[model samples]
Target: MPVLLDLRGAKSSDVAVGTSPISELQACLHSLAEPDHHLESRPWLTGIGESMSPGLGHRLTRFAPLWARRRCRLLLPLSPPLDVDMATELDRVSRLPENDFVAAAAYAVQGGSFDPRGAVTRPGEFVAACEARSFSRGELARSLIDDPGDFRRVLVRTLEDSVDAFFAKEWERIHGRLRDEVEQTRSRLRGLPLAEVLSSVSPAARPVRDGRAVRFDKLQNLTVPLGGNPVFLVPTIHGRPHLIIRGEPGFPVVLHYPVAWRGQPPSIDEVRQRLTILSDPARLSLCRHMVNEAITTSDLARRTGMTRPQVSRHLAKLRSAGLLTSERSGRYVYHRMDVHHLMGIGVELLRVIVR
Candidate 1:
């Protein structure tokens, strides 16, 4: 099912573009939680994991329940100010009412609606309830239900410790880039329609009902009527491979979109090298197969009717050029093309040429 945003009667003022350090911190935690999908953050996460104390690391794990499968619903910023700092946002989160915090935690566990009226008194029953929803973090959920205040403390402490560990430096490094993206997006909004602006943020967004509404192909089914509330579009560098949306009632809808690549554009030589790598007929054929699915060398050999060594040689070249990514599943290693990078080659080349 798709998540629909009814934009009926929504004005330009109803949409806003901004950046939030707290949201980026949450994204960093999520990236650390699921490093496989977030390959871009693997090196940073590895470094933090090695340098941090084990006790602090364990405390970070307490947040795993809130980040079920790398998606979080707890402690999200609700229409945060454009210049909101991490301390201010964290303070806001720390001040949430106990019941609201518990309810948000429960929603995070199952990624669904929760009724506080149906709350269970015992920790065991709370865990059982979460388990029924396929949530495997029993102890964490139990802790949240048993003593919500202590859990809130631990959550806040873990976030604080994480900033001290690595997020502070990371945020400093990427803050300017995030702000640039927001400014550019807002500039676009000045000339483009809301639907076009939404689509530019994420390709999955589509305008519907003659631009009165927009829909996204999301994991959950939801219909949010703007009803005069604002929608915040937040861009994050660490939040790659995920587009998070929070549209709970009584709060402004927030969308955290990923911004790919950083620093500088590729040099002319690098662009030429990538173009040459893809110019080969056999490699282009291989890319056609790998673009949509990850396949093992043996599978590629069979499909292309080429020898194993030939397929390996081509795969190696693709991997070296950063056009391919591979993952090991048991005995077999599957390789897939980085479709986003591949698609951006034209823009990269144009940037270099124009420069």
Candidate 2:
């Protein structure tokens, strides 16, 4: 379903940019499914799944006795990514006067609002001793009933190990590049209006209500419509082919989108050059014809009344600008419109110009 942003009551100051390592890690774990539904290509996760089920953590019964059941119930809900993190966002959940260490995990298990600026979270307390699938939610709640801090460490140790084993080496370069992208994303947000930012968030994000409301339809059967709460746009390098959204009646909405810098939003100078390529009528014509139809370069050349080599040159320029993405099928390569990159470039250039 779609997460509806209520732009009727929103202001320019209503939206902000935030970061969360915890959320990123959660996204990584969620992507470990065998089906690979939410990610584009996760070979590493596929390898891991071949040996173990992505749900193996929830069913850690073989390792511990009663600990198995309680931990299983609790971990599954927590496995669903949170918009906040353990370091910066944990304390806010506990509602403790000084922001205690155990608060975040407890709050998550208990379910409630998280406070950075009074950000309310959806309640995950449904498993409160409620029995389902031969498991008790109360048992899960009891797992954290005694010492939340110690329980947290136990959870972290395994999570950290699992993540480090798969992503540690890749994260150095990935994290560094994502940091740069986040910085640039913030700059662009500050430079442009909120509407423009949403327009360029992702291909799946469609603006509604005259560019005031943007419908983010990333997940199926999810419907979250906000009224007066502020929104946060948190982009990540690893979050691709998926969008994470969380909002409550009284708190801010957060949109965690993908922005992995793989030649997207090319350098400022390069983007300026790329923009000029769009001015060519021939290239624009090719783009229109290829919007929903994947055609071969030779066919595009014929349709555009250009020689095969000439069409190839135009397509190359468009691809460099990140407007077109291609895939090879045996001998012939087919190309289609990169709607996300194309719209993103629009906002990027607008930011450069308006600034």
Candidate 3:
């Protein structure tokens, strides 16, 4: 079941791109909040995550389910095609009606494991909300339930503190550069047809069944039909598995695409250099042997029956080609083969031809 955007009659103008301070904060919290995620968006964020006050960071982790990769659906106030008055928008969300708020809270189940206890008031409403999205639901009346007591207030307070303490200053500096990227993205789509523009949104997005629909990569692939409504492209520098597409079986979808799309064609020099490095038998043997364990220059020379100087020269060439990685142990260096890069070379070759 694909959620089609139905942008068929839409012009390029119909596509909106903008910033959401709310989303930026949310993204930051998600990206920088945990250590397990391999925070690739900002190297410095990894350090920041380590340096954050232990208690404050631990408190934020309690709400991890709400903003992690399988995040909450109740992000309208902070979601894109952003408002000019972002602060005011969040304020309005604080007043969301009781049932709607409950529904929002209910939709945030993780991996089909719906914890009804997490739903404070009207557990049945929460159960129903989960059921509506095709997640399994059941009677929650018997379970001990707690009062929600204005979820919005708690949400606003904690997020504000986290954003201020961790993200505010950094976001101010990052906001402008991302806006320029949006403009540049829009500028490139000026003369292209809507279908081409849609396909180019990301490397993973493809126009399947001609131009009638587009499919994007997800847990399961999502197909979105397009009508001339509107689609928002939210650009960011976040790594893979942060929020990407945000469509809920409806129109006016938001796609969180990367600003600097990473699947670029391999440079000619890189291709030539790596291939050249692999062409020599001694170098090839060295690469093959290093896969199982890191070998010192002297050890590699003894294994290959080559002089230490010769082995060292081959290692230097392989390192420059990114086929080898080296680590120092006092006076000697150990070389390890990057088998992963070797496997990925096929992808680079294909990209050169297709991208």
Ranking by TM-score: 1, 3, 2
Please list the residue runs of candidate 1 whose C-alpha ends up more than 4 Å from where it truly belongs after superposition: 111-117, 120-126, 133-136, 261-355
Candidate 2 residues 1-355, lDDT tens each?
5566656766667666655555565555545532234334467666755665445555322223222111112221222233343443433332333223333333333332233211122223333322232244345445554445555556656555555555456455566666666677678778876667776766556678787777764433445554456666766655554555665333456677777434443334665787798889998899998888899999998888899999999889888777888999999999999887777766555433321
Considering TM-score, which of the candidate structures 1 and 2 is the better prediction for this target?
A: 1
**Consecutive 10-residue window with the lowest summed lDDT within model 3:** 136-145
Which sequence of candidate numbers ranks them by lDDT, best first?
Answer: 1, 3, 2
User: Who is ahead in lDDT, 1 or 2?
Assistant: 1
- For model 3, how does the per-residue alpha-carbon lDDT over 113-197 read when each residue is reduced to its tens digit? 4553345555665555545554322222111123344445666677767666767777778778788877876776787666666
Lowest-sum lDDT 10-residue window in model 2: 68-77
Q: Each prediction's TM-score against the native?
A: 0.72, 0.51, 0.64
Clashing pairs for model 2 are 1-221, 1-222, 129-137, 129-138
Q: After superposition, how far is residue 245 of candidate 2 from its true place, in Å?
A: 1.2
Candidate 1: pairs in clash: none
The TM-score obtained by model 3 is 0.64
